[model samples]
Target: MTMFLTIAVIVLIFVVIFQIAKASEYVSVLKGEEVSRKQNNKINGFLMIVFLVLGLIGVWYCNKLYYGKTLLPHGSASVEGERVDSMLWVTLAVTGIVFVLTQIILFWFAYKYQETEKRKVFFFPHSNTLELIWTIIPAVTLTVLVIIGLRNWFLFTGEPPQNAAVVEVTGKQFGWIFRYPGKDGAFGKKYFRNIDPANNVLGLIWEDELSHDDIVTEQTLYLVKGRPVKLIIGSRDVIHDVGLSHFRLKMDAVPGIPTTMWFTPKYTTKEMKEITGNPNFVYEISCDQMCGNGHYSMKGVIEVVEQAEYDLYMAKQKPNYLDVFPDKDPAAAKADTTKTVAAKTADTAAKAAAKL
Candidate 1:
């Protein structure tokens, strides 16, 4: 209701303004002072110049304000980030130069060619030289830009090194799941039907021996600095983008299809914090696509540490449940169950005796 009322008020305001303009024109006709087309053109030309200067100033001030606030974060932290930044600057410079030149010429022509009684207009229907100049210039510029862009793209998407660290990232409705290949250096096979919401969210086939040693985490991703890391990304539900802003990396996480990205972190978390001068600074992985209502909350943290530190961190993580229980051996599974039951029984019995 409030929206409807606001829209109605705006419509009424426009109607009132239109009526006032018509009435003013009627009053001018009554005064017998004819409207002069040349005078109107001159006024419009002057206003165009004023608007052009003001617009340029406004753009400059806005840019200054944005940079002053430090709204844009620093450059990338990955080895390939410098090349990406260079390409971006090149594109921006080309576009910026064209934008400024076109705007200047546009407003200057408007002011110079304003209608006047004493000045006669000359019309040139066509100029082949002018046409060729505009076309060839843009064509050459675009070709050069495209070549640079394609080269960068190929470099960015090159195959990962053989010694690269392998990590799997999965996106869902409102969260991310990361899995690391444990001691086996192999990711186990996964099946959609085997997915258990509580126990095995990633649906690893417990029967496969390779699945036993995978380490899974919900919101934290760990990496080794100076080591090439290959990320295999997928989504369980809708499409999502795995965005690592600091690395200048983004790839779509599509359901039923896996995508890969590779990068090497040049800076560790501690070093980056000191460089940024923000004690709480940490690298983050965020979902760039607007997938659903809870999309805004889909975020994760990345910790880049030394290789030794990463080894220590991995050593403390518990293996998957299936690793502790071999499905092929019923006796061993039973023995484990018996031990748990016996421990619980003893605890209960002790509690009863204490009450007595």
Candidate 2:
């Protein structure tokens, strides 16, 4: 009801203005002057064109102000987002000019031919030249735009550089994990036997294989800014999507196989750290594809740190933490129990064989 009332009030105001303008246009006629409004049609046409241009300009600027991304964010491993951001201003410029020109042409035609009973029509039949020119110009314009867009698209998703840094991204129902290959260029396979039930140890816990190569156990990823980072993403249990709104990078993290994207950082991690007044450059990573109930809270952070800091950080990670149990004496106490069970199983097998 409030919306209706507001709309009605706006209509009434516009009607009042229209009536006033009409009256002013013929004020001399009302005062018994012999002049007709048709004499001033050229002036009215110019005024209408001005109003049309102003209206379109206002709408264009409003759209730019309302819908836009922030200029700064931490590094992202996708380039398409940055390309779109760069092209947005150009899109606005072209759209604004077209909008203003269209409106001006419409209003000028309407006001220039305002109702005049004494005027005779000047009729010209179809002109193939004019028709062909109009059609060809618009076709060329659209083709140019399409070509430019496709070029950017190809540039963004093209094969990444050979030396791009690879980071493994794994997704779960309610959280994210980033695995970095520690010191070794390759990541060790994970086996399920190593999973500790007491601790909520997630992912394919590769018990026997965690020792050949080290995996950094930290939740957040730390990378030096200005370096090319490639993210190889996968999911363990169900389908999930990796989305970073600030960086404009969103991609699906699927199970069974890995999906990858690459990007180079424009800003240094140290610069962002100082600007945000924190040692970390926090980028919110959320799952775009709903895989479970806790999907809304599924989050991850990327920390852009200096190269030296990142090196020191990787060096401090405990490589054998997964295999190292705090209480190591339990195995010694349970050794005799394991031998007794094996002996009982052998005796039962021998008795069964004799009975047969």
Candidate 3:
């Protein structure tokens, strides 16, 4: 059987290793323990040097191999994200210098300072100057990095330009719902209790005139290229995150608390496809938070276009109000009114028949 063969092979390998160890012990006794230890130390020291050289080379090789595959080569997709990229590069440069220097000094000392009769270990314990240098330098460097990050964070979360296009992003169980304020330039009042999965996706109060003009869409969001857009974010069921990697922005979508982030588009989706040399390039909205079972499927798309194209796209979208109350949709016309009434009557009659 495979199990019996596997066990027998393991036992044989252990016996062979034990015999080799016993032979080595007998050889050490013949050579003298002190000389054997010295020889082993020399070999280990040489291996340390070899390891240091190979490690440094491996580091260089890895960077050369994978650096091009990262977003750093393509640069940022938003003007604000350019600051993020700058901060990232600065952090990498500073840490990289420290890493290479420390590694070289560490492994070089191990190899060069191997036990020898010519040298004796010094008893010097600690130096205040050395401690201060190590402590102060890293502290100041981290403080500067933190301050830079905070400044960028404030700029991103703050109120955007007056002409900025605003979109309300609501995260649900397995998808994203985007609401754009129509001509009125205001989002209508929304209540969670008014939620109806069939049509009233965002639970906007129909009584509000603002809700009548509020444009709602799913799967894709459209924005004007080179225009600043503010996102008002929230979640319906649990916590979710709106991750816009291209813009280098993300915000949590909490159930009761709303969050906001804004960014200006540097290139249209079409332009990005051309720039990246990919025909199917699209801006993605990824859920950065783990909400529920269907979390992986929660995704959305963004289409950045010119002002005229954006206008045409908006013009074609019907308001959420019309979908919720089809009777009020002007496109349905008066002829459809009777059908609506008939459907309601049929529903009521069907319920009555069921009860009987």
Candidate 4:
């Protein structure tokens, strides 16, 4: 529906441009009223033929070289996507009806009295009935649409089903970190300095007491079909947005607080593959916020895998993946920082002393 609308708008733009060009040409060539009017009418028939051929050639070449026969990736699993699909179909139907009616009325008005000698314009002004009809119709239609949209919005935000699983996701300047509570099913405290690169603790580390059994999985998100999943989101360094195009869901993941979004997959992995023409489908999760330089690459993949596969993957992940690093003495850590600064200052002083 959106594609059709885009094409229609493009064609309309081109038509207006052609008309403007023809009007300009006619004005330039006009010498007398009779000659100018005849000249203007002739422009449409011949000009359309010439331009149509040129346009067809350009379109064919563009399609061959650039577009091919590709379908867009629609990867949303949220209710908002379904609402948009419904809105698209209704909008197309109404727009088509309006377009046909408007063109018919315009052409009929123009063709009914073309000749200046034979046609006499009639003026019938100030009809309250006509004004009332046009005003009332549009007001009622707009009101109805608004009401329906509000109703849908209410339902969309109502509540997630009882069995929905909650997953916490945090965003940084150029990466996404997701936390799935281990056996306890709750998130543990996290600190940045405790992160150990060698141990694959890819960022959810904390300095305070950390739970030994808190397993934090890092890779990609995997979910089961027909299940509701709630994502609690936030940012660590800066504000970021979590956007999933196919599901029609986007929410800001602001720092210091959590935001939430929910989705349920209507199709299983096998079904989505058949529908989308891609067997190994992964929803591209993107950051909509201009967080930093690496924002462009800050994307994560989500796969709606089979229940069996999900079970196996979960089983393989160790329960103690988020184990806290050994406790560091605060005094020792501060002493190290002070010692480093002192060493640099002493080296600078030695160089000055030698120069003196």
Number of the top lDDT candidate: 3
The CA lDDT of each predicted structure is 0.87, 0.68, 0.91, 0.69
Ranking by TM-score: 3, 1, 4, 2
Better TM-score candidate (2, 4): 4
lDDT of 2 by residue, 33-129 (tens): 4454555655677778788878877877886886444443332333456775656556767776887677777897888776577778889999999
Candidate 4 wrong stretches, greater than 4 Å = 1-34, 41-83, 103-115, 124-126, 189-219, 237-239, 288-296, 318-356
lDDT per residue (tens digit) for residues 1-356 in model 3 = 99999999999999999998798788779999988878878988999889999999999899999997766777888888898999999999999999989989988899999999999998999999999999999999999999999999999999999999999999998899999998989999989999989888888898889889999898799989889999999998899999988888899999989999888999999999988888998999999999989989999999999999999898899998887777888778666877899999999999999999
Pull out the clashing pairs in model 4: 75-246, 76-246, 76-247, 77-247, 190-206, 191-205, 191-206
Query: For model 4, how does the per-residue alpha-carbon lDDT over 138-178 read when each residue is reduced to its tens digit?
Result: 78877877787777656544566888777777787677777
lDDT digits (tens) for residues 1-356 of candidate 1: 99999999999999999998787677667665455445556778999899899999998999887974451366779987777777778888999999999998999899988876678989899999999999999999999989987886776667888899999999988999999997889999999887777888888887877887888888999999999999999987899999988898888999889998899899999999988888999899999999999999999999999999999999877666544455744556799999999999999999999999
Best by TM-score: 3
Error of 4 at 153 (Å): 2.9
lDDT of 1 at 153: 71
Predictions: Cα RMSD each: 5.5, 11.3, 8.1, 13.7
What is the TM-score (0 to 1) of candidate 4?
Answer: 0.63
The parts of candidate 1 lying over 4 Å away from their true place are 1-34, 68-73, 322-356
